[model samples]
Target: MQVLTITTPWFSRAQEICAKKKFDQVWIEIVHNDLEETFLEWVASLSPIRIGMITESLTYSSDVHEKEPTLEERKHKVERRLKYMTHALVCDEKDVGYLKTSSRVLAMWWTPAVPKRFIKRQRKLASLPYGIFIGSVYGERSKIIQNPELKELMIHQQSPEHGTPYPFFFDKMHGALYHFLKSRLPGTKLLFLFYLHFLRAIRQRCFSLWLEALQNGCAVICLPHYVKTYTGRVVEGMAAHMPVITPDIPDRPRNRALFEDGVEILLYPENDPIYLANHIRRILSDPGFSQRIVEKACRKINNFHTCEKRVQQILNWVETGEEPVYA
Candidate 1:
């Protein structure tokens, strides 16, 4: 199938990946309705077989940005895109619950295992016991991640050193790292874009940055999005063999799908920091327990949610056009 991403934002993102390009998944962002017009115009000229990835930050319930499209407008765009797309991917199983289509594929922001060489290199220079938080920081997203305990953690590292990766407190703070790298490295924009785009997966840059932090031996301090979706950064952390401390991010549809709370991952309550601090303390103080959680998380991620496994699932969906039974 021919993909006309030439004029689309995806084309620019495609330039970053160094790995040989085999897959040609298209993105149909809910935020960028203007791209839909361009994409449709291109599709009209050539019958495009659209395999779209729905954006992860789909908080369509309210308009956060002044220019953000309304839910009805977003839905109309999605339906129009669906008219040409063969399949679409969503962050959660019911993520596209409102979209009127049967081609929806339940995919998290899952990623393949990070290259060991990357992890090995990061560990060599890692400052141990640091925790990294990626994703939005203000308003609702902030409320969810920065409870009393997480706040203290962020404050402790408030004066984050140049290479330090945590307290990535705000949603916008993630870009700071990218800019930092771009300025320091000078002529390696493509390399950063490649990894940022790869995110060790292919969806969001924050996940890739978070994975880099994990590779550096920093623990992941996070909670699932309040949008009832599991941000798959947890999967990346687990896959990287790093300990993950999070709130009770539910495993929907199946048991142990996202996590097993205290087994595959350590769980804390958002309201209480004592539990969060204790979990952190346990990770730092006890080596065996930390190792056990990391091992279990890695096993679950490999068995159920790798970038490879997700791609196969999408392929199977494309052929059958039937949503697989959630395992």
Candidate 2:
């Protein structure tokens, strides 16, 4: 069978799967410019049995008033696209309901391709006395710097340029604050690094930096976000065997089902930096507790959230016309 994936940004996971030779033929068409036209053309050229992966909302009009598409619009776009392909793969489960009654929609989780040795090394490095925060200062992430509880924490924040190429932009006020803090408190242990480019360079730089941060920190802290999806940071943190603390999203059933609070993962109430700090301290002070959580999380990742496993799930669905059965 032949598989054709039409995706935006061309995430590494999609690229890896398309490279496999097991499929009679595999082709990936990235929507760089003129997204709607390119998408329609690809669907017309590909066979009906082809599997198309939609990484982002298709209804996003470049002419919008610099505002994001509403949930309804996103769903409508997804539903419209499903009619052109035999099977569709979407990143979020929330968008599945938009598909046609006869459409086959597969809700695929974003899996990381972390190596075992790298995970082991991160665990060893996490023995150090520090914590790391990996994200930007935009949107809800601004709370991280504003929270007084995080002021004294020996945290290393790595803000890389977001992967998507878009026109929307935000102020760099947090960058100025980061620099001022560094100068004001010369003795402070806070560290900051910035990448000016997009995700094309991420695959090359992200793992090493992530491993370095995980190795140097006792835990990883993810700030709250409006979008409740399972981000790459959470998966990467689990693979590194580092206890991760992030806001709880009750609406996201996949995350709720896959992770357990105070067991395989840690969840915090939104915008509560004190709770975040407390969790970090708890993990650092109790080595036994930290080790248990790390072990459980790593086991979960190995069993369900690896790139290899996700690929098999996709293949099974395409072949059997059945939903993926999770353990």
Candidate 3:
């Protein structure tokens, strides 16, 4: 059976896995109406399975703003597209609702690369001498640094002896931006593209602020995720028994679970920056509280983040052609 992927498989390990399994047809779906000739040539050289997909949305025009399809119009277009494909594979729950009724929409999670050595290492390095912040160091870090009230609490204040590296943070943003630019472009949607660029530039400037915080003895280690887009830091932090603080989105169950206060995870909503600052301060100042969360998180979820397990899950999904059956 033919497999049509809306996104390009280039540089995607997941694509490598899918291709290795021998899908009869694999479409990259570039979406460049003006560059159709270039896209066609590009796909011709790649595996015969690869194909290009274009939409009017890819064209650039002065009236693009007026011509922009509304959410309903876009939804209709997606429905129309679904009529042509055999099975539609979506990356997350956000896209699941948009797929057509007849299409078999499967939510695919990127398979994380957890080094076997890391799991074994975690068993030995079970004690977190420091707090860890694995992902982006965006406005998120300001909760601790910029909030004077939080500093007054001394709960969020770090001693000068505990300097951790900021390369991890910089690397994460770098990887994230690289993926972002490759996945999107100027003509896709002007405002969205511009906002993405603005956010990236903000992060770029924030890199120095992150380094300054680290120099002042922040315990956060900004590290590169194993698979560029996957949440490797979350798993790695849990493994290290480090108390982690990531912003929570109310709608996602897994994200909400991370904020089950005074338990394995602590939640902080970004809207109330002061509250987030206070939460960070509370953990920093109270050693017992911080240690408790780390211990609980390590015990509650270590086995689930294993790379071997993640690989097996991906392989199982590919083999069964289904979403993961999580218990």
Number of the top lDDT candidate: 2
lDDT tens digits by residue: candidate 2, 1-327:
333432343231222323433343232322222236445554445344545565553433353314454644554655555545555665555545544443664444332345444455236632556567776666556766667777666365554333432212222433454565546543222221222233224444556556555555788777765444556677788877788777886566865676789998888877677788888888878989988998888887777777667777777766775666443
lDDT of 3 by residue, 1-327 (tens): 343332222222233323435444444433222223444443344443332232222112233335443534544555444333434444323344434334443334332233344332222323333333433434335455445654443233342223533445546655765676577543334433444565555554453343333322223333221111224444455554456554454344533443355576655564555665556667657878877876776655545545566546655665585655321
In order of appearance, the predictions have TM-scores of: 0.61, 0.67, 0.47
lDDT of 1 by residue, 264-314 (tens): 887766545667777877776787887788777766665666555665666
Q: Measure candidate 2: CA RMSD.
A: 12.2
Error of 3 at 139 (Å): 6.1
lDDT of 3 at 56: 21
Residue ranges of candidate 2 with Cα displaced over 4 Å: 1-39, 56-80, 100-118, 125-128, 154-156, 159-206
Deviation in Å, model 1, residue 46 alpha carbon: 3.8
The lDDT values for all models are 0.52, 0.58, 0.43
Task: Note each model's CA RMSD in angstroms.
Answer: 8.4, 12.2, 12.3
Give the range where candidate 2 is weakest over 10 consecutive residues by summed lDDT. Answer: 187-196
Error of 1 at 305 (Å): 2.4
Mark the regions of model 3 whose C-alpha exceeds 4 Å error after superposition. Answer: 1-92, 100-105, 109-113, 120-145, 150-232, 257-261, 325-327
